[model samples]
Target: MRDVAKVFDRTGSTLGVMDDLQVALHTYDGCSRGCAGCVVDKHFKNNWRFRNIMTGPDMRIVGERVKEYFHWIQENLNTKSDGYFGTNGYKVDHYSYTFRFGNHSELPQDMLEEIAESCPSDFRVFSTAPSDEIHKFVDLRRTHPGNYFLEIIYDPVADRAQDIRDMVLDMRSNGILGYPEVLITQRLLQAYSPERFVEEALGPLGDIGTQLQLGRYTPSKTRGFRTTQVVSVDEEVRWMTAVAKGIVDRKYDIHPIPIGEYAVTFLDEYKEAGYEGPDGYIDVARLPEPEPFNIANVVKKTRDIFLSSIYVDHNLDLHVWSESMGQHVLDRNFGFEPLGNVRNRPIHEIVTEPNGVLERMLREVVRNLATHPKCSGCRYKSFCASHAIPLFRKWQEDDGEHCYGYLPVIREFQKDRPFLTNMIDGFKELGF
Candidate 1:
């Protein structure tokens, strides 16, 4: 019941599946460590740092099929781990997590060791912010390779600086499993310049983290928090450069889960033979060879300024996108010009894991960049290329995987409004 097939725009038919038990508990939504501005923590306010160790909150588990597994999942649910479906049938997306020993009084080292040893599946994941645990997880990965994986989640801004450094040290201590996965927040990346963020991102931790998800906020499903936050392109560029510099300096063994920035760099170089622009779309011949890092830079720079410009009041122009950013994905992946050699199926999609919702979304977006105004062909394509559907959700709201945030950012810097904007303004001006 935890396995649900979600259709992606790029891939007409595909199944998205995750081991319900591991995925749910592993993805910490409720953390009461009181880390200011932690996205998951803020969204689900609970004291997970010092987890109850005895009882979980009342929030419904993600994979729960209200009509189907409610009673089943609830009966076996261990409120202690915030667990559901302990007794459920063979969990496909089985997960395993490890917490740092000795930090929280709730679950002692004995408990963590026992969990690691008794890992239900051949492949398990360990999520930790503690330094020792990070090293241990890496050690385990060395001994177990792809059978078990490690996901590190230490936010520099959320927790103390020492804590983050300690965690990075642990990753460096064990270089076997590549980079220790760490979560770098927009807040941290923005507060400090991208150079600083990269220094930390590329510090001892090797690969920064599994996913570097960046985006604005929507009204939290949990109330009392208001106001949406957004990041622009320039902010992201600085962030990437900082990371690139880190790679150059630290010699960190970095790996991308979806091959994020790496993929962008590769695809951008190959865009020349592929791009089929709309009528007024600028020709490659008319402009400078698009910078490989231009899009990444814009996203980082714009993001940093937007996130940090807390006092700026440029409520100038706002535009919204439709449907989880489908426009961008569609253009890049599936559709062909019917006049060119572009195949109906995108090149990347051929190699994608059908179970991958994120990959499917990426292809669809690259497919759509040409006409999705925010993309501006190559202007900010890096962010669109690097970011996933999750970013789209920032703008799409409850629209189920869409984004329009960039539309507004575009309007802010736009000295010349397009025909579409002019038409909309003229109507508003006349009160008609």
Candidate 2:
């Protein structure tokens, strides 16, 4: 297995050389929040409440299975043969592995503890509401002491502002929450004013040891209730412009997730242009906004989106991507079938086997993306290829109406170049 991994690494194949593997685990069967237009609920054939939930003992078994896979990966995939210069001009010695829990359902303490102990590495815990269980996470952090993230999903319509604020404060008091480690995610809905979203949803949070993630609502076939909530490209561009302007004008202390990333990209471009001022300090305000360029080129230069990450549902079914699992549940014909269940097969076999089902499917997906006429000329091709299968499926289902979900945001970045430049300058001035 090690020899096979070395070969794949040398060839620059996406299969074997993996620096990070994000395994998203659905801990529970049903959610208690019952928020309207829940994506998780749409994954089920019937009501989520009717599904059989995994018990603590069942979760423990799953944890052991994951631990076994992790150990196998550590032994076989973590090291490279000496004197072998692989792709990217480096030898693999160590990599990070993460277990992301409670993405779709509420995770109980017992389940959390079992998974935490089993993995004994970096992990993320998520919650939709304020709970007494926050303390238990703090306790677990003390014992484990690994790089951890606590994600809180705040729905402006469903959750009270004070309740979420109080929860974050409690976590901060316990020394469990900090910048980049604590994330507050709010969904972007259609017709919601970008200014209003910042004022109502983000304003009250007020730099409470948390970063922000603006989640774009994806239209799901099963959940027609949210179909109207899908933001159009125009609206998405407006949202990005508004956020960038807000960051510059209001000087919000919080760092918005991808917006911060985009600002850094622009800043790097500014530096590369040799725009240094007196004393080697570049005057940001004096510099013009970056010219409109393909954001995909930037993404392609940075990293390959096709990293070795997999998803495992509560049923122990392993998938190529986390989004694939949702497609499988919503509509099997449109979905990429699971490579295999972890309960039945080992992780290495499912991922690394030559001429295997997984490899064949991945190759086909890549070929389709690389050959598609729309994708061939598109600026977002590189970024789109990272999520080729499901996105391709959606394009087919929509009769090629949807070019890419993020086109509006990308266009906005180009259209409002001055605002983006100002935002980058503002972040630089604030020492972000």
Candidate 3:
């Protein structure tokens, strides 16, 4: 890892001003859908790895504990500011709950409802597998305005992809809690043609995001769980651009996070520095964001999302801009003291890196929904921050391979300018 050249004011008391009820829940074992490259696989060795929420005293205790977190949040953060309190710390392979209690038709209805009931109804997004039973839960989720969102996750190339997509669309059509997404990664795109697949499977809902976030593969899981087919940034950009354009051309639903802005912004920086292609390789000089990414010049362009209600599961630090990044930090009710620092250490390296974890983290911000680091020179010294956990979980406490798909998306989005400006805009504060 490169040395962290930039210095952060590590002096501040890491005061995390949290919201109402953003707790995190995980199975840690029992079931896994085997996402081609998953971070959860790294923790397979630990006994506590798979806590099996279905059995044991831990699950019973959690059921009650989460409720406490929820009620506490209602009084503190949710009513006014965005004090996120959602699920935290659990490396379950794929699906958390087995839903294996009764016959196929019955499913784990009662228990599932109980789990959902325990979590803060408004402000929490329950990340669940893309199962048929999800629709049932979505119906119930809609009853609560801000509490639940049926997080429908699934692979696109797999056989069940179509089934899952169909069920998701049907759910949306049926007015179910429809914040579902296609968890397609960059590596997966290499294996399959997303353009053709979206055309065939998603049909309409595929139009959700402007660019399907091209996620990267973690090193640990990369050995077996993830493929190490390292594609160059240029090619990655090409492929990502193609997929992004494909979605745009077809008018599919492509909700782009702030990372897309990063890509577009970077591209302009490269061109501004007099870039030129060499030996079939397009080259550009590096003109990184002035020493402090939080220059007033950059912040002048963005808006203030400070008052907005945001989740904080991934600990998305305010200093680090992200695609919203790999997965969102939206409402996860989890413990804070343990997951303080992001797994990706040495923030200095990550901010200006070329291809390592820092670059990837930046890529996530550019491609997805990102919050800019307008805090550099601002006097609003009391405001707290968050960082995406998937990319930095190990640094805090060794765990999973779930955050590697943002690299390509970052490279791709680096070409756009308007997107870049949008991202930079988030940095500026009212007082500044």
Model 1 per-residue lDDT tens digits across residues 1-432: 123231112122101112232221222333334332333433223545434231222112111212122233333332212112133322222222222211221344444444444333344444443445554455455544534333444455654444554555455455523223333335555566655655654454444332222323333333234333333334443444345444434544433222232232222333422332354332446444655544333333222211111110011111111122211111111221111111232212222236443334434555555445445544446444433333443333323222333322222112112322222222221110
Among these predicted structures, which one has the highest TM-score? 2
The TM-score values for the models, in the order shown, are: 0.41, 0.65, 0.48
- Candidate 3 local lDDT, 200-223, one digit each (tens): 645655533222333433333213
RMSD of 3: 13.4
The candidate scoring highest on lDDT is: 2
- Residues 1-432 of candidate 2 have per-residue lDDT tens digits of 122111011232221123444555554334565443455534442454433344455456556665666566555544423211234223333323333322322454555566566545554544334454676777677777755555565566666666767776777677655222222122334424667766766676655524555544455444653455544544454556665455445555555545443333333423322444563334445666444334443223222222245566666776654222121222222244666677767766666677765656555555555567755544344334444433445423323345433433432333333444433333332111
Q: What lDDT does the true structure give each of the candidates?
A: 0.33, 0.46, 0.36
Q: How do the candidates rank by lDDT, highest first?
A: 2, 3, 1
Candidate 1 worst ten-residue window by lDDT: 309-318
Off by more than 4 A, model 1: 1-32, 41-119, 131-147, 158-186, 199-219, 223-229, 242-246, 249-261, 264-371, 375-432
